[model samples]
Target: MKYVLGHKNPDTDSIISAIAMADFLGDGYMPARSGDLNKESLFVLNEFGIESPELPELNEVEGFVLVDHNQEAQMFDGLDKSKIEMIVDHHNLGGLALLSPIFIRIEPTGCTATIIYKLYKEAAREIPENIKKLLLASILSDTLNFSSPTGTEADKMVANEIARETSIKIDEFAAKMFKAKSDLTGMPISRVVSADYKEFEMGKFNVGIGVFETVDPAPALERKGEIVEAVRELQQEAGVDYIFFAVVDIVVDMAYLIMPTDKEKEVATAIFKGDLEDDVLKIPGVVSRKKQMVPSLQKYLENV
Candidate 1:
């Protein structure tokens, strides 16, 4: 079977969408994850008695289906173009060129699973109970339980319908999922800094950004020195000139941004204009990195 996977540093939405798409495509497609699962994804899979997709070695895989992301930067490095048979994403085009005429579906939805849900409806196929729960989980995650700016009416509508059908309370389940996401008890500083990292091509610069969202910020905030070092190492490893990791407070609408070195701090301050407090920038009312941070940074860089 060919593997269907999402971008690297897979979030709950990325991983869940892969599972849903694989099921939607029927036999010959198995859901896969490009990176290790974060706490939230693990909790959802375990909660629903779903086994994690077997990690496929990219070089050995015959062909693959792309879901949740289409950017080459977000995928395996030096990928063979002919290996891609399909592409489905919710983000902007990233100049992905394929050899053959492949199936491509890109939408401006909150989550790729939201698109997958619509696909089911359009095909007149009844979504299974497990897929419904998984889709609801993914939509809630990517939309921050309908609080994120990325959350659209369709996302909220789909989530509500599944919540009612599966008899799952949205608020309660979201709280539990966020709680599980925040329990980064024993993770190393490196993993904490890169839980949800994504690289964006901003003008002439490749900027790597990671957001760690949690109900309580203490777990990440308490490790400032280590986070600093980790960010430095991670940026170097990613071969990016800039890397910013944000410890987002999900309860309140705030985020504490961390950038390595004085140079990075200066660049970030100029870009975000946030208040620097105790080596971390206090970005008030900024939680969704995709909606609030990346587009702004990309625009700024485009003009520079």
Candidate 2:
């Protein structure tokens, strides 16, 4: 049997793409997750009534297909040792190198689901209504409802097509989905910070960034001290050189970054050139970590 999975710390796109692809492949293919589901992913699955994929026991599988991410760091442990049968992803290739030739489909589209939709078209296979809903939700979540800089026209077109098939109003469903993911009212500060966390190795620094997108950033910002402390604890526990926690206001397209240390604060000020207020820096029109934050921080880390 062939196993399909997404990156560790699986987000909505990763989780949904894996499930959709496995369903499309049929026969021997089985869907799986590399890590625990985040709050947003859980919300999406629950909203759609999709069962979460089983977590794989071994890090190395004989035959496997990866989706949503291509980096070894973001994959399960021992992926490099596994026989990679195929890769369908959207992110820039990182340190995943395979010795043997494999079927690879990496695209510049915003979401892997967009690429998968094209594959279904190429195969002349009809997408089921449930799969269409999953694809649409993944695209909306990854592209931040077409507002993210990483989003492309391809993503929008595919989303419209899926919406038409699924009979889901894009605006209404997206608003409901985003609102469901944003209600962090009673969540602990640690869970709030780790909700959508991702780690990157930049130069000599092990950098960790956590993003929390909401309709309003006030509720999270209201607990600034506790959140900052949680970030500090995460930094220490993870042994990361720098940690950044951002509370993004999806409605206003603004972000408030929380930097726990003086070094992190300095880096944020240097990169954003925004004034720090109470250890939080206000950055307007900064929504995407992949398109905006990661590239800028990687360049800064490389030079400094």
Candidate 3:
């Protein structure tokens, strides 16, 4: 049996794309995740009566149809490293194995779910009402409901189609989804960081951690200290050679990269092709990891 899955930090796009792929593969395939679904995603699943498959034992299985996330750490507990036959992701691509996939689909689009939605359309497959709801929710979550730098015209089109099929008032559903996500008051900083952690290796010299935050103003300012401390703690615990987190201000188009080491600053300076100001780097009008960050960093690493 084939297992379609994604990273442990299973975001909406990852979750929805895996399910959609399973739909395409029919009954012989299983849709799975590396860990627990976030509260917001869980709420959507419950509303649609879509039960998450039991967390799969990362053991022997047919080749994996990886989606949304490609980090090796997201695999099943004991699955062979070579068994990941396919990979589909939209995040910063680093640390990928030399011969990891037989079919790799990496796009610069905002959401992997959008890509899956396109595949369904191309194949002339009717997206089930429940699955459409999930895909629409994934687009809204990842794009911050059309208010994110990651959003694109294609994303908007897919979202509209899914909402129409699901009979959901898009605006109303998105408002509720954001409200649920922004209710981050009591959650620990560690949990918040883990909610969206992506680890990247920069050559053999540095490792970075990137986390996305969608909150603004008061809440974001309130959480900054906690986030900085949490990043420090994670650096030690994860034992990465170096760690950094870029807090992207969606409206301002500037990034405040928080790091515990100067090596991170050095790498950022080289990658962004900008000087470090006050020892804090800035990437003006910079957004989109796939389109901007990863490509720049890869070149910088290669040169170094």
Candidate 4:
């Protein structure tokens, strides 16, 4: 049996894409997750009456069909590149030296689910209501209900089609989704930091970046002291040049950069045009980390 899985520390797009892809492929292709689901992903699954994907036991699978992410570092830890039978992602193409021709689709879209919807159209396959819910939820999660700069018209159109078919109010549904995502009340500092985190190869530096997108930043801010200490320990554990954790207020379009130390704060102050009030760097109009922050970071940190 073939297993479709997403990157580690699976976000909504990653989790839903895996489930949707496996369904699109019909029988024999089973959905799987690289890690546990977060509050929002679990909310969506329960809302749609869909079961969460199980963790793929490597030896029990034939090969992988990765969704949402293409980078090897983000992939299952022991997964071999050669075992990647197919890939459907919206991220930049990574270094994959496959000896054989493998199926791959990488698009510059706001969400991987958007591309998957296109695939369904091309194949003349009908999308089920559950699959449609998964796609719509994934798009909304990634694009932050179209509030994110990474969102495009394509994503909006696809989401609209799903919403209309399901008779779901976009704004109302999005409000509920965002509310579910923002409820990170009891999660530990470590899990909160790593929940939506990923490592990237940025200008020779292996940077580990994490973001906790919330509607109300007050709850996370309450744990600010513990978060700083957690980030410090996580940086040491990740062994990256830097571990940057940002608490992004989606509703306010603002970010509170958690600088673990003076050195991180200084470097962040240099990189971002933001105010460093204590260990937290307050950045305005910097919501989408992928589109807004990554490019500038790559340019500025090229030499360093």
Candidate 5:
């Protein structure tokens, strides 16, 4: 049987899309998440009586599919590329789409579930009611209920159709789901980060970090100083490469990417067509790292 799985740091959209793909492929496939599913996603899966399959060791797997995210740097430790049969995702391409023997499906939609829903229709597969509900919920959660800059007309349309089929009121369900996700009082900064981190290879640099701004960049900025200090203290952390953090403002379509690299700053200045201001790039129309930043950055790296 062929299996499809998501990257580490699985989100609602990734989890739900994997489930939907499993349903679409039926007997020939199973769906999995690479890491421990987030609480939000876990709630959805359990609530719907769906259990996401465990991520199989990549060496033992003969066939695989990719969904939601497509970054080799963020894939599970043992997932070998030779086994993948397809890559279906909504995130901006990161060179993995060109890998041989993998049928690539990428669309610039708000959530990957939106794309998966289309596949469901194209394959003439009937999505279960609860699965449809989860898909709609995933879109709402990932797109910040259509407030994110990445949200598209198609996203809203699919979400509406899915909501109707699932019999869930969009506004009320979105409100409840968003509320459940926004409670992050006692969690450590590291966990909050690992819950949404992405790693990328930029030219000769191996950069990895998370992006989000809850209170203010000021808190994260202060913490960055401490984190840098700690990194200096312990020079042998496993995943410690060039770390770049971003304070993303969805409303402004800009993010202050905080990093301690001259090369990254130089590249950002070139991409923005202007000099960076105090290590901050005023990137207009940039929102999600998956959707906005990574593609351009990857192209920039390829050129360099």
Candidate 6:
């Protein structure tokens, strides 16, 4: 069986892209997730009445197609030993090296679903209504409702096309989706921090970054002490050089970054040119981690 999977700590884009790809590829392909779903992804799946994909055992899959991410650190264990049939991602390539040539589609679009949407057009296949909603949600989530720096005109065009077919207003639906994910009421600090986490290798430094998107930042900020403590624990456990989390206020298009160490704060202030207040930097118009945060940090690391 051919397994279609996405990165671990599955975000909305990662989870939805896996499902959409599996459907597009037909009977032989099975959609799967490498890790547990975040609150946002779960909300999208529930809102659209789509069932969550099963987590696959790496040794059991005959071949695989990766979506959303290509980094081995973000993939399932034992994946390196399996046959990689295809890779469809939107991020920079990492340590994934295949022995043979395979079908690979890596685009600079904001979301992987955008590339998949284009593939649907190329194949002349009609996108199902449910799948259309899923793709729309993924785009909105990854692009921060078209406010993200990573979002492109192609992403807007695809989203508009999908919206017309589904009769879903972009702003209204995005508001509802963001509202659903904003409620992190009972979730533990560790769960909140690890929900949408990702790791990057920046020069000799290992960096782990997490993003928590909410309509208001006050609720998350209220638990600042516990959140910072959790970040420290995570850094120690992962043995990473830097551990950071961004609490993004979707309404105002701002991000409140929590950097546990002084060195991280200095690097962040240098990259974003913002003052750090109590180890939290309030950065304006900095929403996309993939587009802004990661790239800026990588450049800084490269220099130093």
Among these predicted structures, which one has the highest lDDT? 6
- Tens-place lDDT per residue, model 1, 39-90, is 9999999999899886777667778889998888998555566888998888
Compared with the true structure, what per-residue lDDT tens digits does model 4 show for residues 1-304?
Answer: 6889999999999999999899898888999999979999999999999998889987777888999888888998888778789999988765656789989998888999999999999999999889998899999999999889989899999999999899988888888988998997788888999888888887778878889999999989999999988888888998988778999999989999997877667668888888878889999999887887777776667767
Candidates ranked, most accurate by lDDT first: 6, 4, 1, 2, 3, 5
Compute each candidate's TM-score over C-alphas.
0.96, 0.94, 0.82, 0.97, 0.79, 0.96
| Candidate 4 lDDT trough over 10 residues, lowest sum | 90-99
What are the lDDT scores of the predictions, listed in order?
A: 0.87, 0.86, 0.71, 0.88, 0.69, 0.89
Model 3 worst lDDT window (10 residues): 212-221
- Assess the local accuracy of residue 112 in candidate 5 as a C-alpha lDDT between 0 and 100: 84
lDDT of 6 by residue, 1-304 (tens): 8899999888889999999999999999999998888777888899899999989876678989999998877887677534878889999988677778899999999999999998898999999989999999999988889878888999999999989988989999898888878988778999998888889998988999999989988989999999999998888888889888999987888989999999888789888966578979999988889888998999998788
Query: Backbone clashes per model, in order?
Result: 0, 0, 2, 0, 0, 0
Residue range 59-131, candidate 3, lDDT tens digits: 5476678888776655545767687777777776656674532888777778988888888888899888788
lDDT of model 6 at position 169: 91
Backbone clash pairs for candidate 4 read none
- Model 5 C-alpha lDDT per residue in residues 22-104, reported as the tens digit of each score: 77778878887878666567666776788766876555577888888778876767777777778788865666644465578
List runs of model 2 lying over 4 Å from the truth.
Answer: 78-80
Model 6 spans with C-alpha error above 4 angstroms: none
Give the winner by TM-score: 1 or 3.
1
